[model samples]
Structures are given as structure tokens and as C-alpha cells.
Target: MGSIEDRLRAVEDQLAIADLRGRYCHLLDGRQWPAFIDLFTEDGVFEGLSAVRGRAALTEFFAHRVPAMTEEFWHFCSNGTVVLEGDRASGRISMEYLSVMNGVSYVSAGHYDDEMVKRDGVWRFAARRLTFYFLAPLHEGWAGRPFHNPAA
Candidate 1:
């Protein structure tokens, strides 16, 4: 059996992992590309509906996709479970993303599979695979209008 101190340390590590996941969502919704990139390990892979590898590639990927959306966006995460093993850990988090475009709102629900590692005393995501369960289609003619500029 693990000692009390060991158990407490494990819980703390899991809580930190959860906090990192939440920060990731916040960075994405806010379009804070640099901050988002900082969350990943140098060799991290981000596989969305489209696969992107490395931080630079992920930046380009976001540049192309995020601006195209004509909406204010929010991503909410729930039911996160983390398993830690020394320097390595894995997690699963359920999520829902909501966006409002031209007075219409759309939502997408999904799950994220994550792998992480502790590097130099800081935890960073080594890989993340986002699997979306459902995505509501945008109403027609929504793209023709100006960008929603959520940051505005």
C-alpha cells in the first residue's frame, strides 16, 4: 500500500493535470495561440479532426481554422480522469464546445484522449487526440458575413 504522503502527492498531480486541461480549453476559446502552444511538449502531437504534428504545425492549423469561424466560442470540459505513473500519465476528458455565429448558436460534444509527461518538474501534454461525437452544422450564409471576432 502507498503511504499517505504518496497518495496525497498522486492526487495533487491529478489536480494539476486537470488544471492544465482547463487552461488548454481557455486558450483555445480565446484564440491565444502562443499560450496554447506553450501547453504542449516540444514534440507533442495534436490530432484534431485533422491531424497536426508539432507546435509550429499546430499554430498554422489554428491560423487556418479559427479565423474561419464566424462566432464567439467556448469549450467546456467535464468528467476528466487521469492516471499517473511516475513521469508518465494519461487522461480522458469529455467536452462540449459552444459557439454563436450571426445570432445562431452551435454546439459540439466530444472526448479527448491525452498523454502527458513530466519534464524538468513541469507537466506538459505529449499528445492529445480529440474525438468529436457530434457537431451541429452552421446555418447557411453564415460564412459570407464578417468574422465574429470573439476577441473583440
Candidate 2:
């Protein structure tokens, strides 16, 4: 068994990671682009409907991609499961999203597969990949609809 300090450090790391996940939703929904990009490492990669590598490409990707999709949206992430290995970790988090697209309300369900690294005692995503089960208008629902990766 690990010592007391090790156990405590693990708890602290878990909490910090949880906070990171929450901050992602808030920053994305708030349209705080700069802060949002900061959540990832300098060479971080994001993959979903499309892919972007490094902070510079991420900046360009969001600046162009997000506004084109919708100006208003809410991103929610939950059910996070992480495996810590010293300063590195891997996790999967479930997400539900709502957005106003062309005046229509749409909902999306998905999960994020993340690889994270802790540098200088701070945790950041090294890579994040999203997979969507479905995305559809509120009136239509998800049944019989094709899955989507809506955003990168």
C-alpha cells in the first residue's frame, strides 16, 4: 500500500482533474477562446469531426469552426473515469450538449477520450477525442439518426 502522502496526493490529483473537466465546459460555453485553448498543452491534439494539433492550430480551428456551427451552446461533461500513473493519466468522460443552431434547439450526446499530462504540477490535456452517439433537433430526437462528431 502507498503511504499517507501518496494517497493524499492521488486524491488531490483526482480533484484537480475533475476541476479541469468542469472548466472545459464552462470555458467552451462561455466562448472564452483563449482560456479554452489554454486548457490543453502546447502540442495538444483534438480529434472528432475534424482534427487539430498544437495550440496554434487549435486557436485557428476554434476561431473559424465554432462560430460557423453556432453562436450559443452549452457543454456539459460528467461520469469521468480516470486512471492515474504518476504525472500521466487517461480518462473517459460523458458529455451532453445543447445548442441553438439556426434558431433550432439541438442536443448531442457523446463521450471524450482523453490523454492528460501534468507539467510543473499543473494538469493539461495532451489529446482529447470525442465520439458522438447522436445529434438531432429537440423535436426530432436521436432515434434513427446517424452518429456525429460535431466538433473537433
Candidate 3:
């Protein structure tokens, strides 16, 4: 068994990991892709509603998807838990997203299963997988628009 101080250090390390996850969501919401990418390791794999591998893939995915719609979108992440094993860690985060497109709105609620690693005193995401719980569409006009793949 570890000493009390060791346990406390583990708890603190988990908190720091959670804080980094929150910052990632904040940067994404703010459209700061470069800054957001910095949170992940170079070979990171981001898989979720969309699967993006590596920093370059993530950057391309964000560039192609985020700008196609209206700019009114907000993403909130909460209810996260982090588990650490030496230099590697994993976490799950609940996410809520709301967006307005061409005056119409939509919302999605989901959770992200994430894998992280500590390298040279910095924490970075090694992988992330998103699972959606529910999605609700708002406004009637959204149905009229032709379906366009955001990733395209």
C-alpha cells in the first residue's frame, strides 16, 4: 500500500489531468485549433462522432468541419474522472454541445472516453473516443437544407 502522501499526490495528478481536458474543450469552443492540438501528443488518435488520427488529421478535420456551419456553437465538458497508472492515464468526460445553423439550432449530449500520457512533465491525450447519449434537433428550417457532410 502507498503512503498517505502518495495517495494525495495521485489525487492531485488526476485533478490536473481533468483540468487539462476542460481546457481542451474550451479551446475547441473558441475555435483555437492550434492551441487545442497542442493538448494532444503528435501521434494522438481522436476518435468519436468523427475519427481523426494524428495532429495533422485532427487539424484537417477541424478545418473542414467547423467552418462549414454558422459560427454560433458552444461545447461544454463536465463530470470527468481520471485514473492514473504511472506515466499513463485515462478519463471519461461528459459533453454537451449546442449550435445554431442558419438561424436554426441543435444540441447533442455525449461522453468522451479518453486516453492520456505524461511526457516530460506535460500531459497529452493519446486517444479519445466519443459516445453520444442523445441528440435533439431544434427548429423546422433545419430540415429544409440539403444534407452536407461536415467533414467534407
Candidate 4:
């Protein structure tokens, strides 16, 4: 919030961060584990039902868990808001997904609370925390049930 140059930089940064989220969805849904993990910092942490820290752990977690649970999947992200502060930024993104497990259809909705850092001109997630509102099989619906892991 300063000169024209500063304002331009802010817009650019926001767009880049948005791109990161887009790529995250594509990579993960596509099961491109290595590239997906690269979206994070080396010490990045992903907190969902459990916490997976560091790129190595993230790779392991996604590679094993996602495949084990989902036969097919698609991730949709929206309602993202980012606040830039020098080299660090924080944001929230709404997420929804359709998935298939053993020929059973499922749906999930959640939001990600993200802490991101700009490192060497690229923004990467330092931490991503997911809180799900619903994770239910398509037929059963989300009402009157507790949130549970899709994998279980």
C-alpha cells in the first residue's frame, strides 16, 4: 500500500499465490506427487486428519494415503484470500472434491488455512491446515453424521 510500483507488486504476488493453489489441485488430483510436494517449502507442513511435515513426508503421505483411499478424484478450490506482508503471507481457500473409492462415490468440503513464504521470487506454502466440514459418501449425504476420514 504505497507507490504504483508497490501496488503492482502486490497484485503480482497475489496472482502468483493463486497460481500455486491451482497447480496444487492439478498436481494432487493428477497424482503427480513429486511436483505436488514441490509446491511447498522443504519444511512445509500439511495438517489434515494428521500432520505431515517436510517435503519427504508430504510425498510419502500423499503417495500412500490418497491412492489407498481414492480410485479417482477431482479437487476444486475457490474463495481464496491472501494478505501479503513482506516475504510472508497468509490466506484461506475453500476446497471441494469429488472422489471415487472402490466404485463408491464420495464428496468432501473443507477450507485450507495457509501460511506461505516467498522464497527466491516464488511463493510456496510453509504450512497448510485443512478443516473439513463434511466428508461423506454421495448416497448417505452429509447430514446427521460426524466427519470422518475418507480413507477409513
TM-score (C-alpha, index-matched) for candidate 3 = 0.83
Candidates in order have lDDT scores of: 0.80, 0.89, 0.78, 0.91
Please name the candidate that would achieve the greatest TM-score relative to the true structure: 4
Per-residue lDDT tens digits for candidate 3, residues 44-83, read 8887647888899989877656656545778799889887
lDDT of 2 at 96: 97
State the lDDT of candidate 2 residue by residue for 1-152, as single tens digits.
79999999999999999998999899888779999999999999999767899999998887678778786889889899999999999999999988887788889899999999999999999999999888888888898887853433
| Candidate 4, superposed: residue stretches over 4 Å from native | none
Where does candidate 1 stray beyond 4 Å? 100-104, 138-152
Could you tell me the lDDT of residue 20 within candidate 1? 90
Model 4 lDDT, residue 32, Cα: 89
Candidate 1 shows a clash count of: 0
The lowest-lDDT stretch of 10 consecutive residues in candidate 1 is: 143-152
Name the 10 consecutive residues with the lowest summed lDDT in model 4. Answer: 143-152
Name the top lDDT candidate. 4
User: What's the TM for model 1?
Assistant: 0.82
- For 39-68, candidate 1 gives per-residue lDDT tens digits of 999888988656788888888777666656
The C-alpha local distance difference test score for the whole of candidate 3 amounts to 0.78
